[model samples]
Each structure stands twice: as C-alpha cells, then as structure tokens.
Target chain A: MVTETQQRLDETHAAAAPVIEVRELVKVYKGGTRAVDGVSFTVAEGEFFGFLGPNGAGKTTTIRILATLLRPTSGSAKVSGIDVLAHPGEVRREVGFAMQTVAVDPLATGRENLELIGRLRRVPASELQGRIDELLVLMKLTESQKKVVGTYSGGMKRRLDLATALLHRPKVLFLDEPTEGLDPQSRNALWEELESVNRSGTTMFLTTHYMEEADRLCKRIAIVDEGKIVVEGTPAELKRTVGNDVVELQLEADSPNELERQRSGIGRMLEGFEPVAEIKSSPAGVQLYVSDAAAAIPELVRRLDGDGIRIGALTMHQPSLDDVFMRYTGKTIREEQANVHFTGWY
Target chain B: MIGVAYETFLLGRRAFLRWARVPGNWISTLFFPLIQLVLFSQLFKDIIQLPGFKESSYLAYLAPGQIVFAVFLGVSWVGINLLMDYHNGYLDKLRVTPINRISILFGEMVPLFVTCAMMAAVILVTSLALGASLVTGIPGALGILALSGLFGIAWAGTSFVPALITKNEQAAGSLSLLFFPLAFMSTAFVPVERMPGWLQVVNNWNPISYVIEAQRALMSTGFDAGLIGKALLAMAILFIVTQAATIWAFRRLTA
Candidate 1:
C-alpha cells in the first residue's frame, strides 16, 4: 500500500539513523569511583569509531556501558537506536562485544566454542555450520578448528574469540583493547582483519591506548582522560591541530657554545622561509617546525651550508597521534605494568 | 520459561563437555571414594558381624555410602567453574548475549545431575565388582543414582554460596570442608545404633543420614518406599533451602 516516494523517504531516514548514540553517560563504581563521567558521542552506521586513552581512563567502562554489560549510573546510551538500560535484551541482539580478556572455553575445540556462542546468539540452526566454516576460513583457523583451544597459541585464541563475536553478524562490534597482548605481527594482522570486517558494513566501536591502532583504524576518535573525553575528531584533523611536522638537525658541535651558535645560525637563516613556522634550540641541535618537513629539508640544508653548521643527522617526522594526545592532555600515555595476584586455588 | 530452558540446554552442553574432556575432573572425584570403598570394606570386614549390622558383608554396606561420597566429591568444588568464568570474563561475554542471565546459573546446575550420576555409577560398579550385592538389582541401582544426582544438586549450594559471597575459589573450596563433619557424623560409616545416644539423636535430623539410609536400603534390602520417601523428603527440604540461597547468591553476584 506504500507509495514509491514514501518508501524512498523511509529508506533515507533509516540510512541517516546513527547506529550508536550516547549522552552524558556516567558510571560510578561501588566505592564511588566515577569510571565514566559525562561522556557523550554518536557513531553513524558503518563508521569505524574509537576511544583512545591510557588504562583506567574510562574507555573500558564506557564501552561496557554501551555493550550493556554494566549499567551506567546516569545518562543514556543507545545501540542501533535501542536504549541500553530500558531494553538491554533488544540492544544485545544488535551488538557484539569482544572483551579485553579473551573468553573462550579451553577444553572445547575452536569449532565448538563458535557453535556454543552462535547458538546462544540464536544464529539459525540451518546456516550455522556454513557460517562457522566461512568464519574459520576467514580467520585462517580452518586447520585448527578441530583442535582444542587450550592447545592454540595466544593469537589463535584471540582470533577464535573474535570469530565467536562475529558469528551472528551483529550490526555493531564493540572491541575493547582487541590487540592489547598481541605481538607486533599479530597486531597488524588483527588490524587488517578488523578493517575487512568493517568493510563488510559492520560498525566498529573500538577502545584502545595504542596510538598507532587508533591512527590506522578509526575514522574518528575521541581522546579520553580522567573519565572524560578531552577532544574528539578525525585522526588527521586531530594531528593537524597539533601543528607542523618536526625536522631535527643534530649539528656537529664540539662545545655548548658552538651548539648554541649553530642553533641561532640555523634559526636566523630559516627566519624568512615560507615553510618554517617556528624554530627552537634542542639539546642536540636545532629543531624546526615546518609545514612539510620533507619538502622544506633540501632548502633548509642549502640555507645552512655557508654558515659552518655541520649537520650530523637530519630526521623529519610527521606529528603522530601521540603528539595530538600530548597537545590535548599535557601527558604521554604511560604503559602500566600488569599486576599478578596469586589466588592459590589453581 | 521456554527460552530459559533452551539457553540452559545449549550452555549445559558446553559445561558437560568441559567436564568430560578433563579426565582429572572425574578421576580425582572418584579416587578418594574408590579408595575408601576398597580400603574401608576390607578394614571393617568384621564390623558387619556386630550386633547392629544386618548385611552379609561390609562391602555391601560400604557401597552406598561410597556412592554418596563420590557424588559429594564431584560437587565440592563445582562453584570454582563459575568463579573461573567470572575471572576469565566468560560470564560477561554470556551476559552480553540476549539469553536469560539466570540461564548461566542453571546451565551449571543442570550438568551436575548427569556428572554426579555418572560418578556415582562408577563407584556403584566398582563396589559390585568388589563383591557388593544390589538386592533390588538394576532398578535399585537407578534409584540410588537418581538419589545421588539430586543430592549433588542440593549439596552444591554449600560450595556455591561461599564462592559467590566471597568471590574466592579457595574460600569456596575450604568452606566445603566445614560440611565434611556432617558427612562423618551421618550413618555413612557406622549405623545409628552404634553411635552415642546424643549422636543418634543428631543422626535423626541429619539429611545425609536419610540419603545414605535410603541408598543403603536399595543396596542391601528390597525397595523400601518408606525409606525412599524419607530420603526424597529430606533431599527436597535440603534442595529447597540450598537452591533458594544459591539463587539469591547468584542474583546478587550477577547484579
């Protein structure tokens, strides 16, 4: 009975709806620790959004709230347009959560672990095996699918855990520090897999302290600190706000006076250069903030050639997410040591 | 309710597989009781000749108690499985699913019936191999296994309540020891008549004694509905009390 115009309007409206929406969400732990404080953000459907912060920065707390694993103390969170608190059951159907800790049965085979979760998620019985086989191949776990997870490597366990989350083809996937414990190679591999998953049209909401991870994966990121987000933007936009790329010239100076002389000499020579925004003296040599360090470096070397400023080394690097984080939070992310407690039961 | 049952069935299969794949789980559970069955039956061979004993051999009387002992051993640390899930974040993973939350608890509980019954059967078969008689035969053996499984479900609360309250596996494990004295005081090893008068009075109210007595009746005598009914009544009361507390504790922990 619907007209063509009305059907088109409905489709447009559905496409415009945000998959994840939050407003002033707060979660205070039992001892009055405000884990998530007044956080709000929205993710459009099929977007790869991330929360970037150090440990205990409420990233996990916020993701858990959105995942409906922990109830927030105040404010609202909606996943796929359903309120998380009012109807968690419905919200759960639209989302998959890959927790920081890998949760898989060690005694069960990889296929068994996936089947158990797939059944619980109500994946159709008829298509379950075919779906599992597809995922197993995608995850590169086809050979190990029949082996118990206890015998699998750490990276294999993580992939299997992720595959379990992906079994039901949720509209959104919430990954909390998905690569926290992976080796560099495994982390890169997981990042590629995550990108492919997002390409298949699942919105990804990831939380991590890894700057490279956020920079590479997220279309937009919110930098969180002390239970609140300090800034939010696309990765490139955030880095742009931190200003120019840095080009450091390690001058070959025999004494402090020579170093200071060469620093001022380089600064005076580059004072009128169009690419140079600011110049400063560093302990080793001169540091220049330039619009594009790679393009400006040859001219800079030419300008300093007649001044007896012998450059020991020249290094030009773009401002990274770490720079953006430092600009906003006034601190770098410090990797904390993991504490192990002996419960004596095992 | 149907949803809960369906979810419980799915999760219970995982729980059962987890137990069956680990040979240590059943082996350690049966080792203590099997050793006790073989050692106690021979050590107390002449004790069956005592005035209060009506059995032909000590092995026949010892078999039922050992069967219950196997069931008890099977469940003593059962709560640790749930605690492991909590620590490892499997519970959180399950919570994120759309299934009923209580299904996680029931998933754990439902599997105990099969495991406890199988563990009891091992001791039962072992006892028979060692020359114990089942006077009522196969039906009686099935009855004894049914009682053992129910007792396992009822008694698991002793481990679960502490585990949930303390959130500590060691505390749950050590707290189960506090119930061992109750088993010893029951007519597990000695008849009520051989105990002191005050002990005999306590045995009348001891739920373990009722279960052991019902199982003993099945093993040594014909089907005694009176004894079976008393055992069922005792276990029903114990099941109601423990399961109610367990459900409350589970709700609190999950909440």
Candidate 2:
C-alpha cells in the first residue's frame, strides 16, 4: 500500500545503507594526549568517502581504529556491520587496508610479495595464481614481477602495495594517503586506477590532505581538524556554502595612513553591492565573496576610480575545495600543515 | 589448527627466502660460528691441562659449548628482521590480515631454527675434523644438535621481547649483549670445577650451565638420561616463561 514516492525513498535508503559507522570514538594515548576525540561519521555502501586533514589531525588514528590495528580508548565502530572490537577477524576479512607507510618486504620479489599476501588472506590455491597474474597485469607490474622490491621505484612499490590490498577482493578498501609522495604523472595514473577500482562496486574510504584528490575522487568528504570534523559534504555542496566566486583585489596607496583609509574606503564602496556577501581586508589585499565576480568587478572598478583609489591588479576565482576548507577551518591547508605539532605516535 | 600450521610453514618459507637473497647474511651466519669455533679451540687449548679438567682435548670439551654458542648467536638475530619489518610497517600490514598472529612469531623462529641447526652441524663437523671425536658417534652428535635446537627455541622467545618493546634495530641488536655475560659466567670455556669459587656458584645458578653439561655428556659419554632430563626441565621452564612474556609484550605493542 506504499505510495510511489515512499517506495523510491525506501529503495534509495536500502542501496546507500551505512557500511562503516563510528559513534563517539575516542583514542587517548599514554600521558593525556587525545589523538581522536568524540568523532563520529558514516560511509555508505559503495561510497567514495574521503577524510581530509592535515598531519596530527587524528586521521591516521581514526583509520587505525577502524582497521583493527589499534584499540580505541572508548566508544564503538563497525565495519561492514561487524563490530570492529568484538569481531575484528571477521571485519578483517571484509576490509583491506593500505597504510601511509608502504608495507612490502624490500628483499622480496614483487610476485613473492603478492603470493605471500594472497596466502595470508587464504585465497584458494586454484585461484591464487590467476589472481596474482591478473593483479600484476592490471597494475602493469608483470614486467617487474620477479624483481626485488628494493630495486623498484617509489611509484612501483606503491602499485605493488595497492595490488596486495586488492587481493582477496575485499568489500571495503581503506587507503591512507596512498599518493602522498608520488609525482604528478604517477598520481594521475593512480587516480585513474583507483577510479576503475571504485567503478567495480567496492566501497572506498580514503584519507588525504590533497585538496584536488578529495575534490576529484570522493563523492563526499569530511574535513577534520584538531580531532574533530569541521565540515562534511560533497565538494560542490561545501563550495556552494562559501559563495559563488571570490574576487582578490590588490590596491596600493601612497602612505600607511592612505592605505588604511583606502582599505575602509573600498569596504564602504563594496558594502552596498547586492552580490557581495562579505569583504575581508588584509595587509596583502582585499578579498570579496560575491554571487557573480564578473558583473561585480566592473562595478567595483568604476567605484574605486571615482573614489580616487588606485587599483593594482584584480582576479576572480571560482569557489574551490581549498576555499571551502579555508572558510570552515579559518586557515589554508598548507598553513595548517605547517602549524601542526605532532604529539602522539601512530 | 591445520590452517595455522600451513600458514606457519609458508611464513617460515618466506623467512628462509629472505635469508637466501642476502649473500652477506649468508656468509656471516654460516662462517661466523666456524671462525669462532676454530679461534676458541686454539686459544683455550691449554685449559684442558688445568686441575679438575677431565676431558682429553680442550677443543673436544669446548666443541659442545660452541655448538650451544652457535645456537645462541643464531637465535639472537631472529628479532633483527622482525624489527626491520616493524620499521617498514610490514607488521601493521600483517595485523589487518586474517592470518594467525602466532604465525608471525613462529614464522621468524623457523629461519632461526635452520640457522642454529646449520651452525650446530658445522661446528660439530669442524670439531671432529680438528681431532675432536664423539664417544657415541653420529647418534650422539644428532642428540646434541636436537637438544641445542630446543634451547635455541627458548632463547629465541627471549629475543623477541626487546624487538617488540623497542621496535628499533639497534636496540634489539643490543639485547645480544645479554648472552655475553651468560656465555662467560657459565661452564662454557672451562669446566665448572676449575672455575673460581664465586664463579662456580654463579655457573651453577646459570641455566646455560645445565645446557652445556647436557651437551658435553652426550658428546663425551654415551646417553645420560638424568643429565639430558635435567637440561630438558630447565629449558622447559625458560621456554614457558619467556614465551609467555613475549606473547604479552606482542599484544601490548599491537594494542
């Protein structure tokens, strides 16, 4: 007797049911440092979820808890509906993890590494050889399959690391900064490969501080800071919250007194504009958040000239994931990365 | 149980393969004990002339002790690769797998057992070639190797402690210093009766003294059930305690 709309809603909910859930998870290390504090989130089935954070922002700690590598101080987590704490072995069977650190044996050959992992994961003997060959070919590692890992380049090692995680065909794959140190070309190649992996219907939970990685790959991202999630939404939705575009204006004055006066002078001129949402002035320049930067900049230039303020340069920027991060976290990702004081060992 | 056993075998094979790949490690593990055996035999040949020295040749007397020494040295290096695995994050990779955690411990032990057994055979053969003979022949030599392998297992358990706690290669390597004092204080170089009064008491208290005496008995005399049984009991206690501590430390490190 359900209506058509209600039936559609039920179907949508069933298809996107949570595969990973964290409830008030906290991890306090020895001596009183809290690495993860009261964090909670859910990653739905087949969702490409990204956890974006700077170093020491508790991203690794949260990932470790879910991977069953470390026990949480309190609260609960479930992976694929199995309690991470109570049934860790069952969860391990369903989840594959590639840590920030590459985990292959340097002296072992590429094929040896994959075969060892396959045996450890208990892939059937009949299928293990074919699976190993398939992964080697898929990763383009077949040519170097017999070479020692120590001789392999960084990018090659990373590919083998991914190959190991992909063995046994895990339902959920957890990758922690998989492309942190790769070159642009290698990063792009890995991105394409990961996209194909996601296309095959496996849920992916990736953690990275790279803005473009999250923006391009993840369907939804959670920006975490100081052990807490600052914002969570799709890239477009989060950028929409910031505004349509940003106008960066560089204006110079003859003296410090004139510069101070010119700053307030521009603020006043832009204040009455209907498209302008907010205006912030800094020593470097003035930034205006607006609905349409193209239409507002022409009007802004006319008013500046009428007010006798000199305009040095002007540029318009579309709202990006970086802008969304700055709007919520009050600092750029690079600045936050520099300011981080790492306290606990992972 | 069979799955765990099979996994342990595979893990063991992997460890041996790692050893095979490194030629420098190959030469050191193979020749280091032989070099030590030859040097100690020549240097301490006069020890047999001392009072209370019952054995005919110092090399003969020192051979069993050297076999035990080879086992100790080989087993101590077991944690070196484990610490390497820790530094490079392989341990975390293994933790997330469905493989039995005990295999991680047992797997490393396999290579150590092979190394110890190899060294045991080499030192025994070297001793025999250098005019040291076994009273009970090949069977007695095999018994000495088997018993020393058991002690190697016990010592290997103790070696894992430093590796798990420190997770540093140098710190784990320093733990080998523990065997130095045990080696010098026990009845390894000279018979306990010839040792100083205070040292004789210390040697009596040292577990290595029982292991040496048991191996010496099997090597010089025929089978002595009492001596071997006593050594077995002492090793059994050490194995139980050290292995328990290792398991606890491993759980804590991962936890």
Candidate 3:
C-alpha cells in the first residue's frame, strides 16, 4: 500500500553508498619523503577493490592511513561514511585490518587469538564462541585451533589472521598483502576464502603483488606507482584500455649488426596493421597491441614476410593484468619487485 | 569506558598468559635480581663496618637496594616485549582496534608491575630469612615494596623510549646494561656519605638513591614520612618525564 512518491524515496535511500572514500591523501615522513602523494580512490559497498603496486609504492602507507593505524599528513578519508581523522574509533568499528605481517600472538592458541580479538572488538560474549567456531570452519583451521600460533604453518597463520580480521564481520576489510609468502596452494585457498567473504556483501580493500590474485579476485583495481595511482578501472576495462591482446614477435637477424635494424623494421612494419593499436619494441622483441589478436595474426605474419623480416618467434596472448601494470609503471611488476630494496624495520 | 576496561583486562590477561606459557621469561626477570642481591650483600658485607654505618647487619642495609634493583630489572623488560610487538606488527594490529591507546600501554604494563612486586616480595623474604628485620615491621616492608613497584613503573617508562627508538631487542638489552651502571653509581652498595664527595654529589642526583634510601629508612628505622615524601617526589618527577618520553615514542612509532 506504499505510494509511488514514498517508494521512490525508499529506493533512493536504499541505494548503496561507498564503503570507503579517500581524497588527496598525503603522507610525508620526517625527512620530507612523501610515502603517499595525494592518492585518492573510493570503494563502493560490496566491491572487491584491489591495489596493485611495487614495493615502496605507498600502497601499504595508503592502506595504513585508511585503516586509521597511521595518520595522514594531509587530505581526508572516510570509512563507512564517518570521517576517519575525526572519528577513528567509529571508523575502526566498521573496518577490519589484517596487516601485511602476521600479527597473531605466538604464545596464544589460534582459538585464543581469535577470542581475544573478538572480545576486544566487542563481539557479544554470547555470540562470540559460535562466531569463532564458524570462522575456524571457514578458514579450515578447526583441527589446528587448539595449537599455539607458533606451531601453525605459514598458511595456517595467515588463515588465522584473516579469521581474526573477520571475527567482528566488519563492513569493510583492509588486507595488506594477505598472502605474500604463501605457496601456490595456500595462496589459492586463501583467495577462495576471500572471494567467499566478498560475496557475503563485505567491502574488500586489498593490496597485492600477485597478478593472478588481482585478476581472478578483484572486480576493480588501481595501479599505484611512486606514491600515486597511475590507473584505475574494472579489470575488464583496464585490460581493454591497454588493448585486448599482446603480440610478441622476435625478429630474425642474420648478424649482430642487423639486430637493431631488424627490430626497428619489425616495429615499423607492425605499425600498419589495421587491428593493432600500439607497438612497443626492445632488443629482444617487438610487441604489438591489437583489438582482436586472432584477426590480426594472419595479417601480421603476411606483413612481416612481405617486408622480408624473418619471424624468429611469434606469440600472442590476451592482455593480462601484468601488461596493464607494465604499461602504466614503465616496467614489469617482477622487474620492479626485483629492483626494490627494503631497508629499516619494515 | 567499560569497553576500555574490558580490553585492558583481556590484554593484561594476555600478558600474564605469556609469562605462564613461557616460564623462562618469568624466571629470568625474577631470579636475575635475586642473584645480584645475594652477590652484592656477601661481597659488600664488610662495607657496613666502616665508620658512620648505623645498621649492625649489612644485609638489612642492602636489602632495600636489592629490592629496588629487582623491581627495576623486572619492570624494564616491558621494553623488550613492546619492541617484539612492534617488530611482529602486533602493536599496529592492536592500534587498529577500537580499544583506547592508553589501555594498550597500561594493559601491557600491569603484568610487569606484578613481576616487579613478586621480585620485591621474594627479595624481602630472603632478606628476612637472612636475619634482616624491619624496624617498622611487616607493614613498613610492604610499603617499601609498594614504593619499589612505583619506581619500577617509572623506570619502565624510561625503558620504552629506547625500545621504540631502536626497535630492537638488542637495544633493550644495552639499555638494561646501562641500568647496571646507574645502580652501581648510586648508594645501592654503600651509604651515600661513605662514597667520595664527587660520587656522593652524583648519587644525590640519582633517582635510585632516593628509592634505596626510602626503602632503607623503612627497613632500618621505621616509616619516615619525610624520606618517603622525598622519594615519592623524585619518583613522580621521573615518572612524569619518562612517561612523557614513552608517549612521544608511541607517537613516533605510529607516525
């Protein structure tokens, strides 16, 4: 028996607002080094947002600021519509932080750690044990719950950490490199668990170096570099921004002198392909970005053959999060990761 | 407010559970100062024979000093625990919780205070067993132990600065070593008047000297309000300064 005007008002009010909002956030260290340089983004409710970056790219700093663990030098952040700086205690109640490093007490059992955090978070004592039991089953740590954290494996500990973060069923969860050092199986298991959590209508903000994790798990991603976000979009949209397919062609050079000439010729030759949108070249090979890789390949080989350029090797792939990262950061994520030197207590 | 008290209670329990789970941690904090007590009293037994010494039993004179040493040593270990928490990301995790920050610090400290009290109680009993009677009786001895616990808290406040600044257990270890020099420089082993004039001037400036003298006064004569007030003032000043430093350290750490 609701009137049309009343129904419209209800619908408007029911629309989901962003669970996380950050604007022009800056964090400068003591020596005037900006760890987070005016970074900004928003995470809509129930969206699994991924932050991809190299080490020291300020991803962790931004996460820390948003989590209310570290204060920002400038700008503003809001969690669950509450101003983080002004009401951090309120913000904390709405968000859960699982740090990059494992934070469980080594002397405490898995159940004890969760129980302690659950109590600190003010989960009702009546519901606390049931929630812990549910989390233990969800994290697949039921059998190991009695053992102290020191006895748990790396994967088990990470699961326990995630369980701790989820104990209160926070509206927004911030996970900083949640599976950094886990093996493939453990990483996959954790990812699956996280996916189920996100599906339960929790807003997720995670920072990770793993492309597959971001690709498979995150619905949207922001690539941060040198303390600022270089690009942000849905996974499909971001991959589309850099073209759908990557065509890597190694030019056959008869001698060392011809290598440079052949690379440039191959690069110029691929530029005229109708389906190709961008071309990049290095000493090892030439890469072409194409809208339709299957349509461009036959035409691509024809041009190379007609130009008298030998195709030493040719491979094509659907553009991956890796290509999107490389295109924005000017280096492969792996290369950047290798060059990163971690110093101090981090 | 209730939430903070609840969190503090849980966190304090966690700290005690750490001691219970690892008996070695409690053992070391408790027994290390006991060894120092026995060694110093036996070695400095002849110092009381010097002129101007009022106590017939040197152990009685040294008992208060040993209690101060034990409490200080036990309390300073809080720094090591805090440093470990920092390195392991436990503090950062805790910071994200809704619990009050002051609760985080005070909860961690409650167990250390307990350790200090236990160390003092054991040392007091040992001194009594060695025939060192308190002129003011058991009540006076309890007062002395309570004062030692206060001093332990002040000293622990100072220790937090180094722990947060260096963020290493080795730095905490080095700071503990520094405490030994401070202990020896004071009248812990001898009366301030018996020391050289320059050393006595330095001891007068030492907060530990006030604590030792306060405890000694309680044990040797009776409850002297003047001595206790002076000791309390010295400890208050030290507590204010060191607690300020510890708060600054917490700021730098979170910053």
Q: Which of the numbered candidates is closest to the native, going by highest lDDT?
A: 1
Stretches > 4 Å off in candidate 3:
A1-16, A28-34, A242-244, A250-260, A269-277, A290-314, A328-330, A339-346, B1-4, B30-32, B129-131, B134-141, B166-176, B217-226
Write the residue-wise lDDT of candidate 1 on A1-346 in tens digits.
5798899998997678799999999888876778789999999999999999888788888888899877889999889989999999999999999999999999999999999999999899999999999999888999999999999998999999999999999999999999989999999999999999999999999999899999999999999987899999999999888689977788899999888888888878877899988776655786667897787778878888977889999888888887677667756675321322122111
lDDT of 3 by residue, B78-160 (tens): 77787888778898788888888877777776666666776788888988888888888878977977887788788887678
Clashing pairs in 2: none
Q: What stretches of model 2 exceed 4 Å from their correct place?
A: A1-16, A249-269, A273-275, A281-286, A298-315, A339-346, B29-32
Error of 3 at B15 (Å): 2.7
lDDT of 3 by residue, A1-346 (tens): 4698898887775465477889999988777778889998989999999999888888888888888877789999988988999999899898998888899999999999999999998899999999999999999999999998999999999999999999899999999999999999999999999999999999999998888888888999999888999999998999988866898887777786677777777767766567878777634667778788888688778887755677788888988888888777657677677645433222
The C-alpha TM-scores of every prediction are: 0.88, 0.90, 0.87
Q: Provide the lDDT at A59 for model 2.
A: 90
TM-scores computed on chain B for all candidates: 0.98, 0.92, 0.92
TM-score winner between 1 and 3, please give it. 1
Best by DockQ: 3
What's the ranking of the predictions by TM-score, best on top?
A: 2, 1, 3
Docking class of 1: medium
lDDT tens readout by residue for model 2, A193-272: 88888998889999999999999999999999888899999988998898679887777777878877788888887767
